[model samples]
Target: MTHKIAILGASGYTGAELVRLIATHPEMEIVALAAERKAGMEMRDVFPHLRHLDLPTLVKIGEIDFSTVDLCFCALPHKTSQEVISALPADLKIVDLSADFRLRDPEAYETWYGNPHSAIEMQKEAVYGLTEFYRDQIKNARLVAGTGCNAATGQFALRPLIEADVIDLDEIIMDLKCGVSGAGRALKENLLHAELAEGYHAYAVGGTHRHLGEFDQEFSAIAGREVKIQFTPHLLPTNRGILATCYVKGDAQVIHKAFENAYADEPFIELLPLGQAPSTKHIRGSNFCHIGVVADRIEGRTIVVAALDNLTKGSSGQALQNANLMLGVEETTGLMLAPLFP
Candidate 1:
């Protein structure tokens, strides 16, 4: 029962990651790969790290025959994903790794992304792709929307406490540090070696980062009320991880207990010891999220920190996990690789 998989935007970082993970997948095979500008080039040529993989030559999205592809992973840019996905076969299953279909409301999408969504019907139909929380929904979904790397890391830190009512909703603050790879492979003046090699700095401050929409939407839905959280993200000098430190008003022990209970059965979520903290180095290049909780020096203040590879657990790895569920395959297949440690 091998499922035929297709990848769009194959030249991008996330798309190449999907190809890397699926190359070892037991029940999945790459049938076709599409890239707008990289079409006619071999994947191994575009990404030399993938030279060992015998993947198909990249083609334009319109050139591939979707009927032969059991599932497609769209790793294109935001607005581009909506347009491309809208034109895909109506019944073809899809896992979109862009900001396009994540926000359910067209107005909310416009507010966050500054563009009205082109696929309203598909947007409403797409399930959120946070695999642990949205497993059941993803298994039956025709389309799945992958979460923002920052959003996913923050949610992992706060979702349990929010669900348990153990934290002060109004006082929540998430300060995250992410590796530059989360920015995609696109060239940018800020991402140059000279600029990013020596230091790191915060970019999205004061809730201006778009992922806040997800935090607001998901956190609000879980608490059954409007929950506005202060989120600030920093870009680190490294290449592939996200470390989020969350501040909240709560009992540290109680928060630990809540996290333990919630993530006990979740395979990819690793809850650390009480008063301990996690570093992105431990979970790099894997589909595992390490969480730690410690009490702040101030009374009633607790800190929760979470770490995961932004491209793995945060994006491509998550897309594969959802695809497994949607295809009725074992959810953890080809995704149980251990985190790379130094």
Candidate 2:
């Protein structure tokens, strides 16, 4: 059965990535595209790369008929996602690519997001959309919240270690770097070509990045206690990809074994051989995440790294993965495309 899919905030990078992936999905069709600011323009006008496809014209969210859509991919901004999704039809399955519903606690949401969740009821029902960890839950969920690109990359490298009791939870440190596209299609002085093209710098230092809310939620849940990690993110000048290096107190062989055993047969997650690390370029434009493990100079410490395309596995591709499960279709369908390499 072909599912009718709608993308809200189609003018953004993540939305265009969704269109790029869904254009090849055998069981899904793009039926509606919404971009409030670019509402009257054709999708081709907003993204010339998508000019070849026969896609729906861009419209405001209010102009679309939700009843005909099987699922909706919400790629709107953080605070705006909650408002837009709150007004959507109740029966529609939603995959929100925003921070609006990621944190389970409403108080934490307000603290980090700077506003009370507008859709409290929906927030309560939204499933965290980390495809590997929450596969079963996502399959039956009505609303799925896609993770932050940085958070997803960090978790991929460390979740298994925490689960297997192989790492010191208190000492986990993640230093991540992401490309400019992860910043979205917004215009800012810092994101200008002249400013960002040849430099790299870290932001959200001192454990202040909002995606920490997700790291806190998932890690605490897995360890059955509070697990906080030191996280810092840097912006790179490239177009896409995230490389997260996680430092932990653990035995190298044990850490490798834990991740290898956990993702032995997973579709989108690939565990590289010991001492062989993964690069962001290897997973570009695909929904695959590659994780590697190596021993640190210290006897009882290990370094784990994970890489993936922030726009694909980190956002839109992840949204589609969850949507497939929610719709009872094969989880890996249309998502098995090989990563692009230089």
Candidate 3:
């Protein structure tokens, strides 16, 4: 029952993370690794931390025989993901960790990503991979689009509220903080140790961040109207996790009850006791999300905080969770590893 897996973009942060998780999966095996730039090198050579396991040498995407791969984890860059996935076998099951397939409308995709989607027909078939909310769809999907880490974190805090009509959709505000690794493993001057260390700053201010497209899509769909939250993301100095602090107009006790009821049967989503907040340190390197709710001093206002490993529950771990459903295997398999903490 082992699923033969191929990881495209194997040298990136999310790609290496897939390798780390799959190494321990009881029913999935990595049969190929593709990183066009890193072709002809061993995965361990590119990521020494992975030196402990035996894996295929990195190869260009064109060199792999997709016909043999039971499932593929497309961890490539956004535009690149659509281009590569468009040409793969039609029947190949895929979990895409890119923004490419996440938004359903090609026009909206172009509006946010600045280019027309290259694979329109494929977009039509792609299911949004917000595991908890779309479990049934994911189980039957051939292609699942993983959500942005920030989007995932925010939705965990607010989706239930929106669904229950317990919060005012008009006044939602999400101030999120994300670790640098969420930016990907690509080298950039801003991400340089000297520049990023000791200082924290916010980017994509004023509703320009692309993850807004996701928020717009999901929230609007849930509220049955155009729901846009004031979202501002700050870059953290560390290497993992996302903390989304959301402000909403709602009854505090009702908000807490809504979340507790919504996630009561879910495995990965944890609802903390009232007045207690979750920290990124608590969920590092684990496929778990901790959500906390607290009432503001002002009546009818609530603050919801959600924390998760940006690389794990935020990205790679999410991809694997959808892959499990698509493969008809236990959804929690190979993903119960505890969070790493000091």
Worst 10 residues of 2 by lDDT: 115-124
Which 10 consecutive residues of model 3 have the lowest summed lDDT?
Answer: 77-86
For model 1, give the 10-residue run with minimal summed lDDT: 200-209
Please identify model 2 stretches exceeding 4 Å from their true place. Answer: none
lDDT of 1 by residue, 19-136 (tens): 9899999999999999989999999899999999998999999999999999999999888999999998999999999999999878999999998888898888999999999999
Q: State which candidate, 1 or 2, has the greater lDDT.
A: 1
Candidate no. 1 TM-score: 0.99
Each candidate: RMSD to true structure? 0.7, 0.8, 0.6
- The residue-level lDDT of candidate 1 at 99 comes to 94
> Tens digits of per-residue lDDT for model 3 on 206-319?
999999999999999998999989999999999998999999999989999999889999999999999899999999999999999999999999999999999999999999
What are the Cα lDDT values of the candidates?
A: 0.94, 0.93, 0.95
**Model 3 residue 300 lDDT score:** 92
TM-score of 2: 0.99
lDDT of 2 by residue, 1-342 (tens): 999999999999999999999999999999999999999999898999999999999999999999999999999998999888889998899999999999999999999989987888998899999999999999999999999999899988988888999988889889999999998898989999999888899999998889999999999999999999999999999999999999999999999999879999899999999988899989999999999998999999988999999999999999999999999999999899998868
